[model samples]
Target chain A: MGPLFPQEIIGEELNILIGFFIGIGFGFLLEAAGFTNTRKLAGVFYGYDFVVLKVFFSAAITSAIGLFIMNQYGIIDMSAIFYPKTFWIPTLVGGLIMAFGFIIGGFCPGTSMCAAVTGKIDAMVFIGGALIGVFFYAYTYEPLWKELRDSGAMGKVNIAEWMGIDSGLFILILTLIAASAFYAVTIIQKKVTAKGDYQI
Target chain B: MERSKKYMNPYLAGILIGVFMIAAYYFSGEGLGASGALKSVVVATTDMVAHDYATEHSYFSARVSDPENPPIKTWLVFEVLGVLVGAIISAAFAGRLKLETIKGPNVTTKTRFITAAIGGLLFGIGSQLGRGCTSGMVMSGMGVLSLSGFIGLMAIFGGGYVLAYFFRKLWI
Candidate 1:
């Protein structure tokens, strides 16, 4: 009954409309969580503020738990979704590249978009650069990136299944880990900020 | 100038976003994403300008080759459009809308802009290779217990921590 769009239980127009509303909520939460602030986002890595960690892990745990329960009750079919394949090699390399982007650019793609719309000048320039980059990639896809992009194909696998553990149990473990990390970050934040103020 | 309202509690905002994620999956059979829309928009724009070139290119062709379903006409694109709208509304109500460059006190506007441009360029390339950006790949993947999500999570933040010291002047 769930995943209404794929099943055609919902019309295409309706599904798109729903998606827009969801995006609005997503953007709102992102800005409200202070993710639009580069200083605040950077704080997670610098040990000054841990808001990013708190929000990220909290959201992940929440979604995992919610999905698990919904699947248990047959409320949604997890198999129907646009599941991602694992391109381990590319992901690793790409992730490192993105990491540098985060440090130097001061915003991720989503946050940059949100910040750009809210009148962040740097974010506007960042988006401009991204557009050029995307265009460049498309032009050079076959010659330069085709090989690396398609490398290391592990199809449709997840952590719980790979570990040979139940999804519910794995989520429980993840929640526990996140909880401890949340606690640990709080303590770390206090120590770091004690040395000097962190202004965002 | 009126100061911006205090941000919503981080955990609360996270929970609300998580709820939105669940809804996204339920309604559309996927999670939140940002980069996919970027790709779509680019492909569509390219196709609009030069239909033959876009449809012939290996990467753009995948979407642009389909005449009936143009690259821009998709759920992700609409969702991203809504992100812009929603961000505007939120910033408006919070009194946070202003034009300014965000940077460290020590950094010049020129240096920050140059870094920002380079950073964005790299991120665009990375997201294409990795198949998604932060929201789409790592976090949403993890929501479904995907291994790629965990690997990406580690690679991103782990790499960030490993490299943070070098970029200390950029933020701290």
Candidate 2:
């Protein structure tokens, strides 16, 4: 009864429009959270700020819990939604590369877009670089990336299933971990910024 | 100069974003994404410039083969357009719209730009290989407890922590 578009309860045009509005909310919240600032993003690694960790974990947990509840209430069909397949090898390798990108560029893809639109010269350059990278991969696809990209074809799997734990229990454990991490980071940030040498 | 307004609380903002994620899933059966739009743009550009070449290449051809609907007409593309609009509006309201390079005081602007470009380049390649970037793969995937999302999240954050020491001058 849910996932309006998938169930044909909504038409394609309206679906795309919904996507636009959702993107607006996404971008607005990102900026409001200071994600447009590279310092705030990089602070997670440097311990000067834990905004990224706090925002990321809370958001993930919120969505997870909300989706679970919605599915439980029959308001949404979790099975019909688009979930990413687990290709462990490429995801791990690519994720490592992205980590370097985050530290070096000080922004991820979404955040960079937000920053770019908000008049960040560095973000503009980053976008250019991303485009060039896309082109590079596209041209060299057959020779370089096709095989690796397709490797490690594990079908759509979730952590709860893989760990042989109940979904509710996994969510609870994750929330506890995030809560503890949040406390720890607050302490760490106080210590690091107490030096007063670093300013964002 | 007027000081920029303080940012909203991170936790509150996260909840808002989470709610939006839920809305996205409920309405469109998809989640948030950024790089996917760029992929569409690239495919569309290649198809426009070299119709035959694009069709011949597996990467571009696979995407552009649907002649009836261009790649730019995708849901992610429209969503990205909205992201740009929303960001601009938010920045304007906060009076934070200014052309500048964000970097550590220790690093020169040139170095920052160079590193950002290189980093973005790497991210682009990685997203293609990884099937998505932070938004598409990690955040949205985590929403549904996808295993790849957790794997990607650990790799990105853990790897960042490991390499953060070496790249200290860049951020700190």
Candidate 3:
């Protein structure tokens, strides 16, 4: 019933247009939440600011719960959407690499775009780096990455399934975990900012 | 004129972002992504400059739809473009729009830029190898409760924690 574009519920051109509008809203919230600020983003790792952690975890849980409920109510066909296959090894390795990038570079690709728009010089540099990285990966993909990329192919296994538990229970546990993390970070933020006149 | 404005409450912002992600899935049958859009740009550029080479290349060829139509004409690209505009508007409203380099107090601007570039390059390569970035892989993957998402979450966040000390000078 939903997923207007992929399901052909809406015209192709209109779907793209909708994508544009939705992207704008997504970007706006990212920036308004101070995602463009490298320091704020960095704070998640450092315990000075927990905004990134709070925002990221909350969003994921919210979406998960919403989708689950929507699917249950028959409002949307969750199966029709493109649920990415679980390539565990590559994803783990890749995520580790990206994490290193985030710590060193202080911006993810999406946040960097937001930062770049607001005239952050570092964000621009990150953009250049991303392009170079893309080119590098592209050129060496077949030789260096192709095999590893296909490793650990656990084809579309949900986390709940893998854990041998109910999705609702998993989500509830996740939500509780997220809430605790948010609370812990708030405490850490107070402690971290207490000793110094840090201007974040 | 005044000091920078405070950002939106993190929880509120998270819920808003969550709603957006849901909207993305509902309307487009996809979730939000930033890196995949960038990949399309890279592929399109490479194809435009070196058509024969692009066709021969494994990655480009894998995703190439029409040989004539540009690879950049995809959903993520337009979505990313909107992200830029939206971020700008938000910044303007908040008065946080400034031209500055962000880094740790000890880190030099030159060092920051260099690291930013290197980090970005690493992220770009990793996203392709891993098949998504934080937004695309980690966030969206988590939404569907895919094991890939959790693995990615651990990798990126856990990896960051592991590497943070080494790069402490960059952000601390």
TM-score of the second chain, each candidate in turn, equals: 0.95, 0.96, 0.95
Off by over 4 Å in 1: none
Which 10 consecutive positions of candidate 3 chain B have the poorest summed lDDT?
B62-71
- Give DockQ per model, in order: 0.79, 0.83, 0.83
Per-residue alpha-carbon lDDT of model 1 for B40-159, expressed as tens digits?
888888888898997787888788767778888889988888888888888888988888888876788998899889989988988888888889998899888888888888888898
Residue ranges of candidate 2 with Cα displaced over 4 Å: none
User: Which has the better TM-score: candidate 2, or candidate 3?
Assistant: 2
Error of 3 at B62 (Å): 2.6
Q: TM-score for model 2?
A: 0.98
For candidate 3, lDDT tens digit of each residue in B66-117? 7554678778888898888889989999998899887888888888888899
By lDDT, the better pick of 2 and 3 is 2
- What range of 10 consecutive residues in model 2 chain A has the weakest lDDT sum? A191-200
**lDDT for position B150 in model 1:** 86
- Sorted on TM-score, best first, the list reads 2, 1, 3
Model 1 lDDT, residue A75, Cα: 95
lDDT of 3 at A51: 85
Error of 3 at B159 (Å): 0.9
- Model 3, residue A184: what's the lDDT? 84
Tell how far residue B41 is off in model 1, in angstroms. Answer: 1.7
